[model samples]
Target: MNLAMRRSPWATLTVLALAQFIVVLDVTIVNVALPHIQSGLGFTTDGLQWVISAYILLFGGFLLLGGRVADLLGSRRVFITGLALFGVSSLAGGLATSPVQLIAARAVQGFGGALLSPAALGILTITFEHGRRRNIAMGVWGGLAGLGGTAGVVLGGVLVDSLSWRWVFIVNVPIVIALVIATPVFVRPIAPHQGNRSFDLLGAVLGTGGLLAVVYGVVRAEPVGWSSAEVIGFLATGVVMLAAFLAVEARTTAPLVPLRLLRARALSTAGGALALNGAAFLSMFFLTAIFLQQVRGDSALRTGVEFLPMGGAAILGAVMATPLVTRLGTRPVMMVGAVLNVAGLLLLARVDAHGSYPTGLMPGLIIFGAGLSAIAVPAQIAAVVDVSHQEAGAASGVVQAFQQVGGALGLAIVSTLSTSRTTSAIASGASQSDGLTDGFHRGLLVAAVYAVVTIAVTFLSPRLAPSPEQIAEAAAVAA
Candidate 1:
């Protein structure tokens, strides 16, 4: 073991968690700055969404491959490489003078994120033994993961308002420099997976292509009619490619995702629940940002400040989850979270054009933020706890992939619905503000429905009962 690993494992966790935070932060930091970016680069409205989509598509599509690579190579090597790439890409993005340049840089940043996230997670799983210690670490990890995107909104506003939108990307340079300097001193290397299993090149190609096509189709379905030949062709191609990917996985000796991993009821169900949670959670952010700025006429800075409470609430929920999971187990705690999520979304559906933040928005944001933290922490723990060390990266990657894909698909669906409703209301002579508010409420209602389904799924899914050995470990930790 390295001197750092021998002296303090907590140091290693901190470094890993910080890296994860930066990766997740980039996902939403650019959202609030989109208008600025578009105006600066003279981008068409349709082309602007690609600034976000490019990152998500590549991040989601390559995660499994990235995870397996982390396992085949050492985690430390992959993590550092990813950090360097991310730093370079962020610099490129900050210097970008054109729409294409910025979008390309963002896509590369996403690729680096895919490499960093799973490897950091795999290192965490191996560094901390399973039980209370691991649970606590996961709670912290989950809290940071949950906070990153929401906090990004607030940070983006501050940066854009005080400085320029370019500062949002430039700010990462200093942080990345700090992390790189500290990494060798604080984090230790882990052994790679043994045996000579070749990387699944064919599986990676099929899976990446299929996911890209599907996400593209979903994103474009709103601008172009769903019945458009482009939408149908992309969707059909995606499905066929995914089926082929699965076939390849079944036959390959070392698949990108092991088929046996899907048989674990706890992991599989948690992944599904996480996907649904992602759909609702991300939609909440997207719609609320629009409602605050467009309907309520709040400035970007004010919108960011308004979101501060949600971030605090999420951190608190993560802190509380550790003991709750210890006392009640993962399934029950997750079900409670689902109930809170449904209630919060239902309340949010009451937002109107002439509403105030406290009565109309704060209540739902607080409740939903708490619920999101609860679900995210436990779902993350359950997804990897049952898996072997060698498969940890793949498991983490799968859970995160579901989240990215869910967010993309959910945003597309809700945005399409909101646009259609707003257009219809305007056609009927409603004012623009009221029409937009109406559409936002309708979208919130759909999000509430998704939360309700999440509750049902949590109830019906098999419980993640700890094994006897795990129970003993927990008891010892308590003592």
Candidate 2:
């Protein structure tokens, strides 16, 4: 037996989950600190965006490459390497003196996250045997990840208020250090697949480049307008590059992403459904955050605290989903979750211009948050249902990439629509609060539509996943 086989599996899982938590946390922790970062770094109003955009661009762009690399190399090696890079970059970002320096650090941090997140998932899937145990593991993984985003805002608020904005980045250092030290002790060494290990240089370049351009364009659309020349140019280029990448993948003998993976019905279906779930879920958070601060007149700290109930609901839903999935299967549970998401969005859409949080927000936030978790846990499980142990990293990367792209694209579209509605309302005779409320309603409605679409896509998933015996047989054949 290897070193890992001797260690406790749950301990191994705890290490992986903590690493992924920090990765997810960084995605939103910076949001609460943006204003402080601007003043500290002397960033221009427009240039301040690069602090966040730099991270999103790199993290979203390099996920596929990171996953494939983990598969080509070894999961434990790649996971540890990612932790070191992420920790070092976080330290650099915390100590930066200039906007340029900070932005550069954030970019590197994002790249590290790209490498770490999927590899962590790959290790988890490999460590746990698929079935009830894996389902429970995924539930914990999915729940913590969902909670991390919500926690980021809350923790960022406390750090920025109590200490300085730099603490947001600095806080990750100790946790990462602990994880790096523990990983090798608890995690097993999964050897790389033995064969021709020729890397797909062309596919990696085109795929990463294409995703970067697309994410950059999507993020830029809100500030610059989708019609802006810069937005149009980047988006057009991204489409062309992505098309070329697909063509290259189809022809390459050793493709970065083997095209055959798409033929796995469960993987494809779950990826699509999760993309839409990401769209609605992220947009809901964005819209609700603004509504609380701008319309409800809550402080940033208070706003973060207010979201706690919803975050708790998400955890509960995640815990509830594991047993339900083991009994009912993935498709039915996914459909129910998607429908609940739509119901929640509609409730949020009806928020009054002047109303209490309990009456106007709690109901919707609780339902939406729970629904989001329900979808996430199952979709994560399904994404790897038919995938072999060797490709777990790549499969995890694909699922993460889909969600990242969806969140970016959905946020852009929903925010644009909301802003236009608010502008129009203000142009007429509406009060500022009323106009903001109208805009939020419009955005929430759009998010509701996205959830509805997710319900439709969930239907494509098989009613039942392969039995544990069948999964083992398949893995053996593939190996």
TM-score, cand. 1 vs. native: 0.87
- Tens digit of lDDT per residue, candidate 1, span 4-31? 5543768887888788888889877877
* TM-score against native, each model: 0.87, 0.82
Give every collision pair in model 1: none
Query: Which candidate number has the best TM-score?
Result: 1
Which stretch of 10 consecutive residues in model 1 shows the poorest summed lDDT?
A: 470-479
Question: What C-alpha lDDT values do all the predictions have?
Answer: 0.78, 0.79
Superposition-based RMSD of candidate 2 using all C-alpha atoms, in angstroms: 4.5
lDDT of model 1, residue 31: 72
TM accuracy, model 2: 0.82
| Candidate 2 error regions (>4 Å) | 1-14, 31-57, 95-104, 121-147, 181-193, 219-228, 386-393, 420-436, 465-479
lDDT of 1 at 171: 84
- RMSD after CA superposition, every candidate: 3.8, 4.5
Displacement of the residue 144 alpha carbon in candidate 2, Å: 4.7
